[model samples]
Target: MYRYTDFDTAFVAERNRQFRQQVRRRISGALTEDEFKPLRLMNGLYLQLHAYMLRVAIPYGTLNSAQMDQLALLAETWDKGYGHFTTRQNIQYNWPKLGDVPDMLDALAEVGLHAIQTSGNTIRNVTADHFAGGAADEIADPRPVAELLRQWSTDHPEFQFLPRKFKIAVTGSANDRAVIKAHDIGIQVVERDGQIGYRVLVGGGLGRTPMIGKELADFVPQADLLPYVEAVVSVWNLLGRRDNKYKARIKITVHEHGLDEIRALVESRFAETRAAFGGHDVALFEEIAAQFAPPAFRNAPTEVYDAAYATDPVFRAWADTNLSAHRIDGYAIAQISLKAHGETPGDASADQMRVMADIARRYGHDELRISHEQNVVLPHVHKSDLPAIHKILKANGLATANIGRISDIIACPGMDYCALATARSIPIAQEIATRFDELKIENDIGELKIKISGCINACGHHHVGHIGILGLDRAGVENYQITLGGDATETAALGERTGPGFSADDIVPAIERIVEAYLEHRSGREESFLETYRRLGMAPFKLALYGEETAKKARAA
Candidate 1:
């Protein structure tokens, strides 16, 4: 984890001071609601349907025990008893009083966390693979580059207000766990010849218009990554639409203008961006990279882990689902599920946060991670410590063995909290999880991702789920639409919609029908839901969902 330097600390402190004054002015009636809107948004505060929401950045999803403890404190003190972890690997407090936000900001600043650029039309949090340093297949840790980008972008004079909000995700592994292809700017760390460089992608987004990123630069040397990224953003910043907010995204810009033209513009801009940095940014990157050096790992016997796995069925299930391969011999990366069967997808109670912090301190290498899938990760847990960690998590209601399963859904804070939402995403996600759990077939069904969004904004990343659910207001009633075969992995693809929208009452049954269809037609359990969907196409699923009559009628038409 990157520790905040004196300058970083001082900058955050100053920002907090300024925001404190801004909050006071709004409370004192010196600033009206309209006047306070942009100011509050710049600080990552949103006026939701019910209350004010505060989003705090977790840089590259890495944090220590102290930082996790601070998050728990914010949840316990300023907001509700729980915090919602988002797809961007950030956390949102849905019920914060307007006046207490500055205090919350100050508390976050103490832990080197802030909410800047989280909501505005600027470069949002620079995200990376949650298992960056720990993944077995990584070429290099992407967090150093992510941190460099974060430092460069935060409060940068040139990019504070772009035509639309931008996002960037980086991954060092060949497997795309970070969903980099769906970001405004996606960076993949690749080995070329003998050197590590970046493979840059641009124009990927997942709102009303979902797109997989195209290669902006096939290979950019590490030394030139910062300037090259700036060039791409700089080109889009000027070329992107400003008239209608709907078409303001860089995705739309790329759609309107050909990639060749965009490349030319970026190349022209890169010359200037490259020169301005000189060599200071590279030095800064090297400094930031050093801060992210892998923690000291221990060589330990895995007999305890093996023994526990053989003896305890509960531990076995959790371990099988939650653990990932770590780069170190004796270490494993463990994901703590926030999506318990009937609970909100990403909400973690303050006590749960503290429990995770304690486990990270005592078992993990004093480092904890928040996954983009809305789970906490102990990225460097030794195998011998698995049982004890599992026991503690089990006691705290964080030991759900449903990672990548149907019940382990990714849902946004929809109508329940978000003012922009049309229908309730939480209840839909809850119903689906509970129904699948009761059936007890989710484990047997194999890996599946079910993402739900309340609206077309795709906050839940429904566009990339194996079974994607999009909730909308049909006329005056709540309706849900289903999409099939979407993937967020290396072979990224947007889901295809299945005919008409279903009523809220019909959505769960529709999902069940699709799952049944997948089970019936799959080559074997070896083939996942996504594989079945892609292999058989939408025909079988559609027949199962809408029945033979509608399917035949549609096909004939």
Candidate 2:
């Protein structure tokens, strides 16, 4: 929700001008594909299999109604009439032309949004908790800090070309909804002896080498956050591997060089950088905070809300599933589900965006949010507005009543779209969600997370799901690998891989077996699937998935 200042606006305008010229050169054949690649990548454009993909940054997944309208306009005008929201809280358009991207960028700039740093091997978008400002349990809103880092890192000459892409996530709540530990740098806002500070974690990531980062600093005063962050990045920038892309992420660096050594190096750099610290940007933070101020709440019609809840079963189901905790008493966070059974996980049509925008203005507090899980949140909707909002949402195919259920999956654009992918992920996710819903097992089994990635890039946060599915190509055939017991909450842990990969035909049945095993092995309904998995280990799951004969043969061996 941070508004662009005059300076910010000017900078974006200038960047667009340069990119327009670059696009002209490419179209005119003055620049070759090789020459145009990095230039377009800098502006968040990628050449996909069928067309060019443009990833637009939605800073920390926060957007106003106007911004949502602009995204809808871009989708209608530029490429397809829809956009794909990603795990990093950004949106991607899969069908932008090479020449029309600059115009799209200009449209985004008009709304104080741009595609800058959405991709490339440089510092990407700084993400935080989607419910940053609205969470009732938050110590402070993390968006201002995210906004600060965004401005600091945007086109920073020193970090534009780092050894590998960097990601930073911040959360102000005790619950780690942002999956901070799976980021290159994770900052948690905490209180120490009555003073506000940050708990910093570095070198955590979820690619081939998934790791839960170790705490680097217990509590760093807020005033020193930027300088200390600079120190950490400077150390990594100087020492991180540049030759091998696979070994260049901070996670790899921390694995090779011990955490103690990296901590020491960061401390040394911090000592030097802290000495030269000019002053704190208190005024800037205040300015940013003002932009995100809470919307004015109106008195609600309590009787109307009670009557709707009492009368409408469909509205009741939606309220039970799609509504989230809000900071305000009379208000709630209404989630617009993109995971509507068999559709692509994050794809939203232009008309859906428009509907959401209208709902936000009419019922919500004029604030819209994009969850990391690829859903939209009307952050401050009054209880009395639930029926009307739900009606419009239902008309637009947005009322799914599945927020954290098995159907609500996070999937990356896999082999179908991504050039780097080895197999398809979206179809697999769709199949699984649809199967579970059809079987009527989603609610019966309770809360479960199933994340799928097309490859080992882990863009879907597969490594952190309760049930992680990784798709791979084996001799030109698609195969799926399952990992269980992963979590992304405060007690974050990477899932341990199960035995052998399953064929495409066998994957869904295997998942069903695993779920059935959890139910059979659980102590009671109170114990969830993960708790049962942790208690019994993978042995039962192996038997359930592959048959007891196979399990017995492996055990005998």
Candidate 3:
């Protein structure tokens, strides 16, 4: 993990001091809500339905034990007992008072973490693969470049306050675990002619108008990475729409003006931007890369892990679902599931956080990562430590044996916390999870992604889910719409809506119908829901959800 430099430390301290003053002004009525809105947003504070929510960034989802302990302390002392990890690899405190936000910011700064740029139209948190350094199939760790991008974008004068919020994600692996295709700018680390570089994709997003980004550059040399990125965002900053808030995103801009024109404009701007860099950015990247050098691996035996798997079915199930192949032999990437059955997805209690921190300190090389899917990751855990870690996680209610399964849902706060939401999303997610658990066939169903969003903002990443659910306010009633065949991997695609929507009460049953239909239509158990959906389009699923008569009537009409 990269330690904060003196400059980084001082910068955060100063920002906290300024925010403290701003918070005091707001509380004292010197600044009205309107006046304080942008100021607070810049520091990652939002006025939710009932309280002020603070979003703290976990850059590229990386953290150390000390930082995790601080976060746990913040959750225990200032706000509620738990914090919600978000799809952006950020954490949210849902009940912080206006007066306490400054103190919270200061507390975060103490641990070399901050809420800066977690919100606002400025470039948001630079996310990467959760298993950046530990994944077995990575080209190279993407965190160094991600950190470089973070340094370049944070408070950049020319790019601050763009038309709307921007997001960038990088993935070093070919598997695309970072959901790169759903970000404003997606960079995949690749090698061309034995030279490592980036394959840039622009205009990808999932809000009101969902789009899989177009390839901006097939391969941008690592030397020109920062300048090329700047050029792309700069072009979008100027060309993106400001007349309509809904149409202001770079995705919309790219949609309106074809990729060719956008590419041409970016190329034109790249010439000047690249010239001004003078190789300094590349030097800076080299410096950052040094900070992210891989941790020393232990030559631990995996005999214990094998024994545990053989004897304990519970540990075996969890290992089967939550563990991934690590780069180093005898090591495993352990995904701590926050989505424990019926609980609110991605929420970790203060005690649970502390337990995870302790486990990380003892067994996980003092490193932790937050996945974009909202799970905590111990990226480098020795296989010998599996049983002990699983025991602790189980005791803490953090062991859910469901990582990419149907029950491991990704859900936004929805109307319960978000003011922008039209309907309740959390309850819907809970209901579906509980229903699936009762069915007891989640493992049988295989790897399924069930993502739920309250509205069209797609904060839950519903657009790219294998089985996406979008909750809406339909004539004062909570309606849920389902989409199928959407994927977030390297071959990403936006899910297609399956006919009419269902009411909240009927949504779970509707989903069951779809699942049952998939089972019936699939070639075999080997074919997953997504694969079946892709092979046999939405017709079968629609027929299942709406009955044959309704499907026929709709088709006939």
Candidate 4:
């Protein structure tokens, strides 16, 4: 993890000091809620449905054991005893009081974490692959680049107040675990000939105008990344619409103005930005590269793990599903599913956080990572220790083993928490997960991503889910819309709307119907839900999900 430099430390301390005074003024009745809104948002404080929600940034989803412990302390002392981990890998406290936020911010700052840029229309947290350095398929780790972006965007005067919030995601792995396509700017680390570079994707986003980013540059050398990224943001900042909040995102700009036009503008801006840099900022890249050096790995036996798995069905199930491929031999990346059956999708209680911290310290080289899917990653856990770790996780309700399965859902804090949500999403996700667990079809169905967004903002990346569910408020009633054929991977494609939306009560059964339809229509047991959906199209699933009349109308073509 990148330690905050003295400059970084001083800057954060100053911000916290300023916020403390501002908070005092607000509480003393010198500033109204309207007057304090922007300041609170700048500091990542949100006045939510009930109380204020404070979102703290976990840069690039990376954290140390100490940082994890600090978060647990915050959850226990400041607000609720739990924190909701967001899809962006940040954590949110739903019950922080207005007056106590400065203290919370101070506490976060003490641990090299801050809420700055976690909210508002400014550049949000720069996310990357949770298993960046540890992933087997990565050409180069993307964490350094993400850190570089974080530094550049943090309190940058030029790009701070854009039309809307901007997000950037980087991934070095061949698998698109970061869901880069759903970000405003996505960077894929790739190798060209013998040198590593970035394949820059611009204008990709999910909100109202969902768009898959276009490849802006085929191979931007690592040295030129900062200048190039600045140019892209600058272009969007100047040209992106501000009058309409709906059209403020880069995705809308890309859609309204052609990709070719956006590329040309970015290139023109890049030329000017490059001249200004004169290769000075490139050294920061080197400094950042040094910060992200991989942990040393040791060879170990898999015999103990095998023996335990052979005996414990829980350990076997968790190991089979929760573990992912690690770059180092004899190591595995352990993804602890926050989306356990009937729980909030991405919430971890204080005790659970402590347990994870303990596990990371004991077995995972004293490091932890938060994945974009709202799961925790023990990025460097040895395969030999899988059984013991599984035992710990199982006792703590963290060993559900539904990673990428039907029940491993990514859901927003819908109406239950989010003031912007039209209908509830977490409960729907919970019901679906619980229903699937009851049916015992999760592992059998295999690798299905079911993302749910409360509204069309698509915060949950529902548009790209294998089985996308969008919740909406229809005439004082909650309704769910299902989309099929969506994918979030190297071969990314947006899922199409299946047919009419289902009632809130009808959604779980509808999802069950879709899964059953896939089971019947699939070519074989080897065929996954997404594969079958793509091969046969949405006709059969639509027929099963909706009634015959709607199915007939949908399949008419």
Candidate 5:
């Protein structure tokens, strides 16, 4: 958790003050909705279908108890009783009145959080591995670099109004929990001959045109990272398509121009940018890095955890599914699931947020993290505290042991809150999760990532999911399409469509057929859905989904 310095605090205060005036002008009719659009977007406010949605950036997904409490307070005071955690690791309050937005921003500023750069066509929140600091296999924590990028891009005049919105994700682990390959800029912190550097990837994104980022630089030394990143963005800023918003992203730019040409342009630009840096950015990175020093870990026996694991099947199930290895002995990372069986995927009530905040402060080193999977992470919990933490989480409806399962879905706000959505997505996600829970075979099925988006925008990251669901309006009815075998990992690949779309009524059954097909065709129970899909390919699943007659048609097409 990086504490805000006096400068940081002052900077946020000034921004909030400015936004407050902007908000008043809009409310007072000094500015119309069209005039207020960009101003509101710059401040992370969106005029949704029903009401204004305020998206607050949880930079690098890091938070302390106080910040979490402030989020809960915002949910309780201004909007509905719950807040939606997004795939970007940001939080959205979907029911705020236009006039109360400034007060909400002030409340967020008090906790060192803000809504800046969340909605605009700018570098969005710089996300990182939720388990950054204490992951078992991390080379280094990626949050420091994420924070550095946040400071670099927040209001960078040169890069703010790019051709389209840009996103950057970082990961220090070899396992790719941050989905770096699916970002506009993916940074992997790697060590080369004991010298820390970055492996930079560019042009990776998920939308109408999904792409896995290409390797822009194999090893950029720590000192050269900022300039190199800037050069890449600068090159794309000038080269990208501006006439059509659909093709404006850097991914399309890379596709239009070969990676080699992009690399050459970036390198050429890098030379000038690197010289301009003159070691200042490196110095600043070092100062920023110090703020992210790991919390002092305490050594203790895990007798309580051992006892609970042996005695309570309930606790054991949660521990097995929700817990991950921590770097330190006797410590573990606990993932709190917001996707309860029949509930919304990422909506957390204010009380539940408070409970998590309390648990983090009590037994998790006073630090909490929001994962891009729409879950919360207790990144530094001692094993000895697992039982008590699980007990607390269970009482608050946060103890769902379905992490990485079929029910642990990633879904966008869709038609329920997003005006851009063509059809509803939340109901589809809820139905799928509920149906699978009814089946009681999720544990048997193994790791599955089902992502759903209401449209082609891919906000839910459906392009990277094992079972990707896209909801669209077909003629006048809601239709859902499916893509199989897509991955968002070190070996990232986009899923392929499984033929004709299904009606909303048939979507769940189609998914069930796909799962059944996976179960029957897999080499063994251990063979996951993704592995089975890879081995058997789309032929069998399409046959299962569309049946023999339609399968022939799909294959022919």
Candidate 6:
């Protein structure tokens, strides 16, 4: 909810002007594609398979009605009629023409949004918990620190060109909705003896080398937060690999050099960096925190919500799945499901965006959030407004009633749009979702996360899904690999891979076999898939995937 300051306004305007000129140069052939590539990337314009894609950052995934309306405009005017919400809490326009990117950037700037640092090997967008201030369990809101980090890293001279792109996420709650463990730098807001500080984690990432972050600092005081983070990034910037693009991430740096050594270096750097700040950042954080104060709560009766739950099956199902507890009594956080049955996961048409924006304005305190799970969040909807909101959401095709369920899949725009992808991810996700819908037993399955990535980049966060599916190219055919027992929560762990990859045609049936095994093996509905996997291990799931005969043969051998 932080508004752009005069400096922010002028800075974005100037950046847009520079990018406009760059676009003109590229179109006029003054700059070749090779020469223009970096420039366009810095502006969040990517040369995708068919056209240029523009990724617009929704910092900490916070947006107002006006901003959402502007995004809908962009979707309608420039690109295709829909926009894809990504795992990074950004929106991607897949069909923007190269010539029209400047105008798009200017449009975004008008709404106090930008594409700066959304791409390139610099610090990318700073993300936080989608339910930051509204979550009932939060110790303190993490967005103030997230905003501070954003301001610090945006165009920071020393970090403008790192060996690899850097990512940072923050969360105020213990539930870990932000997937902090899988980020380059993860900050958890913690209160120790009446003082709010941060529990910092470093070296956590997915992709080729998946790792759960190690604790960098158990407790960094609020005053020392910025400097401490800078020291960590500075050390990685100095030590991270530059020779191999694949291994250039900070996670690799931490993997090679022990955490103890990295901590020592960061501490040594922090001493100097801390002294230089001289409490300026502390004052700045206080100002930023003031901007994120919770909105006024309405004292309303929940009788309508209770009555609807009691009478309407459709509304009850949706309420059961999509609603989360809010910090304010009599209020709830409504998650708008982008993964509606067979639709492309995380995609919202222009009309859908407008509907969500309108709902937020009318009932959700004029605040909206884009969850890392690729869904829109009306973070502070009153319980009394549940029925009305649900009605509108149903009309807009945004009410899927599948939050945290089997069909609420997270998928990247794989070979369909990404040039780096070896196999398609969206179609696979669509097929699985459709199959699950046909089975009509998703509710019985319970709290399952199916994440898919086209390649090892792990953009879909497959590494931490309850059922992780990674798609790869095997001799010109798409082969999908499955991993089980992955959990992205306070107790974070990477999933173990199941033996042998399945062909694209067989992947859904393989998943069905695993689910059926879970249904048979579970201790009633009380035991979830993840819990069953944890207690029973991957043996049963493996047996289901490869058949009991194969398991017996392997045991005999």
lDDT of model 1 at position 452: 98
lDDT of each: 0.92, 0.89, 0.93, 0.90, 0.93, 0.93
Residue-by-residue lDDT tens digits, candidate 6, 1-557: 79999999999999999999999999999999999999998999898888889999999999999999999999999988999999999999999988888999999999899999999999999999999889999998889989999999999999989999999999998889999999999999998999998999999999999999999999999999999998998899899899998899998898899999999999999999999888999889888989998898889799999999999999999999999999889999999999988899999999999999999999999999999999999999999899999999998788899999999999999999998898889998898899999999999999999999999998989999999999999999999999998988888999988879999889999999999999999998978999998999877888889988876764565
lDDT digits (tens) for residues 175-226 of candidate 3: 9999898899999999989999999999899988999988999999999999
Point out the higher-scoring one by lDDT: 4 or 5: 5
Candidate 4 worst ten-residue window by lDDT: 202-211
| TM-scores for candidates 1 onward, in order | 0.99, 0.98, 0.99, 0.98, 0.99, 0.99
Question: How well does candidate 2 score on lDDT at residue 40?
Answer: 90
lDDT of 4 by residue, 1-557 (tens): 79999999999999999999999999999999999999999999999899899999999999999899999999999987999999898999999988899999989988899999999999999999998899999899899999999998999999889999999999997788888877889999989889888989887877666778788888999888889999999999998899999988998888888889999998999999999989887888898899888887898788897788798887888888888888887889999989879999999999999999999999999899998889999999998888888888889999888898988899999999888999899999999999989998788898889999998888898999999999998899999999888887778888899878999988999999888888888888889988898888877887787668877887787
In angstroms, the error of model 5 at 268 is 0.7
Q: List the residue pairs that clash in candidate 6.
A: none
lDDT of each residue in 1-557, candidate 5, tens digit only = 68788998998899989989988999899999999999999999998999999999999999999999999999999988999999899999999998899999999999899999998889999999999999999999999999999999989999879999999999997789999999999999999999999999998999888999999898999999999999999998999899999999999999999999999999999999999989899889999999988899999999999999999999999998999999899999999999999899999999999999999999988999999999999999999999999989888899999999999999999998899999889999999999999999999998999999999899999999999999999888999899999999999999999888999899999999999999999999889999998887888898998779877876677
In model 2, state the lDDT of residue 359.
91
User: Candidate 5: where are CA atoms >4 Å away?
Assistant: 553-557
Task: Assess candidate 6 and give its TM-score to the true structure.
Answer: 0.99
Candidate 5 accuracy as TM-score: 0.99
Candidate RMSDs in Å, in order, are 0.9, 1.4, 1.1, 1.1, 1.0, 1.0
Show model 2 residue runs off by greater than 4 Å.
553-557
Residue 514 miss distance in model 1 (angstroms): 0.5
Candidate 2, residue 229: Cα displacement in angstroms equals 0.8
- Candidate 1 has a TM-score of 0.99
- Worst 10 contiguous positions by lDDT, candidate 1: 548-557
- In model 4, the Cα lDDT at residue 232 comes to 92
